[model samples]
Target: MAKKGHSEEQILRALRQAEGGTRVADICREHGISEATYYIWKKKYSGLGLSELRELRQLREENSKLKHLVADLSLDRHILQEIVQNKAVRPRHRRELGRWTQAVFALSTRRVSGLMMLNRATMNYQSRRDPQHALRTRMRELAASRVRFGYRRLTVMLRREGWKVNAKRIYRLYTEDGLAVRTKVRKKIARRARVPALRATRPNERWSMDFVAARLIDGRWFRVLTVVDQFTRECVLLLADSSLTGQKVASALSQVIAERGAPMSITVDNGIEFASKAMDAWAYQYGVQLNFIRPGRPVENGYIESFNGRLRDECLNVEVFFALIDVRDKLERWRRDYNQVRPHGALSDSAPAVFAAQWTDTAVPGPEPVPDRTGKPAAGNSLEILT
Candidate 1:
């Protein structure tokens, strides 16, 4: 009824007329169209009315304008903002970019740095920092435990436990917080010469012994027979008293053998007590080789000699024994503690007992290479003489 491809409103109006019993041919002719066109319009726009078409057209026009207006407005705002921000920090532009003005004001006086060395220059400024309440508590705990750790060591410890920090930072914090260790710096004593080369890697391979003398409270002299495991630095045997004869020494050694087993070789200084026939017979019976140091050369038997020095410094200097019984008791306690608790730097801070446990026994030579009378290498002579 409507023109070809007619508007939805016109088509709907035509369909309404047809439903009211108007002839399809008459409706088509009234609309300047054909009968087939009227029927097609009726079928397509039977439900849609004139008001719905007007509403949809108005909505589409309004939506299109809204999109175009939003796009133009956004572009204008971005250009204006960029131009304003790019302006110099002059009095006129400062008001528009207030935050930038503040930043310029703060850093304007700072000099341009070309070769600034931080921490060693005038510009090195320290900011006020909040103290770590947790680290202070931990340091106090370590101190109470008598662990004796320095700031660097403490920093390492904290790092091991997942705390992020630097040693110098920790040290500064320590001094400021009064958590630094207040220890008396004793004079650095010269290190003693190292023990002679025994190179005993196996247990019961080489045993070295020496005598250490000390005075009791009554001024009575007492002697300590100190024997050590050369590879381990373990104080295997310690006997107290000067009345110990060669026979007594033998008996004491026999007792040690009964407990810890006999060594393959026993080395000692050429003392009368050790060189006697009684000692020689004991060595033979026990299948232990007896090696004596060169006469007038105490360093040749240095393993036991070094042990004596340590024993005096750690134990003998700590107390005044009133009697042999007191000396014996103290010696026993010291030996156990030394073997189990005291850390040996030579053994990488492990106790002798711990070191011994970790050691894999190997057959070490009898001694280092000893020179012959003509200053030539002695045949199969393992003892070395340091001239």
Candidate 2:
């Protein structure tokens, strides 16, 4: 309701006139006020001068301001209490607090949001996203089967199975579902200056050979001879036996050579099997050079070393072999998967077999020869190595 516009001085003067024997009806008519309003004003502000009236008005305004301040402080205290009780940090949690505040404090959404320092939109949000029950179920299945696969690799696998998904989405769901794999932290080593190894420009241009060992469930140990093509990152051969001699290694190489042709050179560590006479004879027969790395320098044969590490990590470490037959069967299956299914980051996330099939062996020029001490080109082939 609109208030009457009688100034404090006017009201006080009217009351003084009434007190000084003026008729109430006459006073009301002069001021254009009802007699009831005059009496109410007199009852409220009787016996006061203009200065005292102004002071009372000022004090009333100050008291009203203090009441507003107290109400705001009470609201802030309630918000702080809610924050402490819930310890809400995430937006979802804060939204819950907003609901509680609205119910408890009888506040509107805007007021509660303002008090809680939360976004009104966030408080009103309801997720319309799919639960992805099928996707999550399939992802959990894959993770359970392949315990070492990370979200990135899992994304590749999901794509292969015709899922239209990306790694970022998969990673979000992967972490939410707690399917992340724990990785081991390796000790950092002091790097030293060393000669680089030769990079293979085409499949079968160069091969790396190495041996890995594993124990069967019966506690009987077996050795696996791993041969990898450096260019394609393909596992050329995986031979597992109770024991592998130099002759066995040579035989395995001969079989691989029969199928895929002989490489120009083979990089191998200075292991007994690789350095034996049988291996040398086999290399001589195939007219392939044997580039034996320095003793204890496994990095020189990095391709096979990396392949061996994966073999142990993904297959050997996870499986328990019962017999030589079981070992061979498991190794064969894993080798096929490694070549055809698993994604290689260095191969642009392509499988070894797929990358090899897509590769075009364009001729790249060889590196220039290193100069001698006299600044003249050396006579022999240049030493080009892979980093």
Candidate 3:
């Protein structure tokens, strides 16, 4: 016989009839059900009224839906935990995680995207842009050659070489290609307020000088005397020797003066070479004022100090010197590159020489001075004082 479907009302009515003194076998026969089915229904619905039976069926349906909801939530929690473990923050990383989730959990893209909080379209996106293999290769070569250069400087260099690229694009490619330069974080010091150094308004108006020391391969120490034009940010002199005395320092200054004319003033720290009588005689002869910073205060001559730090970081620290000649050769080459090729941020991302040339091209000439009645140059009319 085929199985019969019984509603809650019909089953309750049959059970009530059996409970009202009708024989269970007669009820089973009349209902076309076996005696066993009648007993089971009577045991389950014997005391329940129609209202209570309806409530029971409704509760069973609600419980099934609740179980399904809990299962879905658990699966979602599992996927979220996996994502968190992977620490996926970038969209590209999240997209990769979504694919892994789909493959591992046998889930659809829609489900994985929902759980990962990523867009379905983004997860499925494919780039149509060029791979830029040549650009990346060139960038890597530049980075390798100038290991201390950042993406901004590299972008400037690339533009100079005819590449139409922006800093943002280069930075993205820099990170993607792992060409980032690592820098050390210096310790910060808290100090009282200080008087700011005077800014330079014209080339050769002011110059700053400092010394940096490094060791040779044979464990002998040598010193480099660096002189920079404050206005142009140009390295005027980079003299390297085993020992730089006051006479040697004066000679170097004279050499620079012969080439670029004399600066109005020179800023230097209170070192022995700077304070020597030879340096004093040289300054007096040139009529150039020597501005000596206070003892233990290097910030008073901040320009040369900044340049020295860069020289130490980029050139000295990276090179090995076997002899004094070797040191001089390396210093000279680096000084040329620094002045003519390397981009300086203070120069608007232009090389120092390039910026100086541009300034020279745009600068207007001053008016001629009036003649004096004494048939002699007026006092304070000399270029030394006027500068």
Candidate maximizing lDDT: 3
Q: If the candidates were sorted by their TM-score against the true structure, best first, what order would they fall in?
A: 3, 2, 1
| Clash count in backbone of candidate 1 | 8
**Per-residue lDDT tens digits of candidate 2, residues 238-258?**
999988999999998888877
Worst 10 residues of 1 by lDDT: 109-118
Clashes of each: 8, 2, 0
- The lDDT per prediction is 0.69, 0.84, 0.85
Summarize candidate 3's per-residue lDDT along 86-202 as a digit string, tens digits.
997788778878999999889998988888778999889887889899989999999999989999999999999899999999998999888888898889999889788788777
lDDT of 3 at 156: 92
Top candidate, metric TM-score: 3
**Tens digit per residue, CA lDDT, model 1, 1-387:** 234356666666678888898888888788788777767665645677688655655676688899999985775455446545576344323333433432443322122111111112223333466767887777667544433456765665566568888878787667656666555676887768856565885555688988889999978898889999887889989899858788989999989877776777778987889988899888777767888878887867778887886788657876779899989998999899779866666887677897777653322356654443335443223422232
Runs of candidate 3 with Cα error greater than 4 angstroms are: 1-88, 96-115, 188-192, 367-387
Clashes in candidate 3: how many? Answer: 0
Order of all candidates by lDDT, from best down to worst?
Answer: 3, 2, 1
Cα deviation in Å at residue 68, candidate 2? Answer: 29
lDDT of prediction 1: 0.69
TM-score versus the correct structure, for each prediction:
0.48, 0.64, 0.70
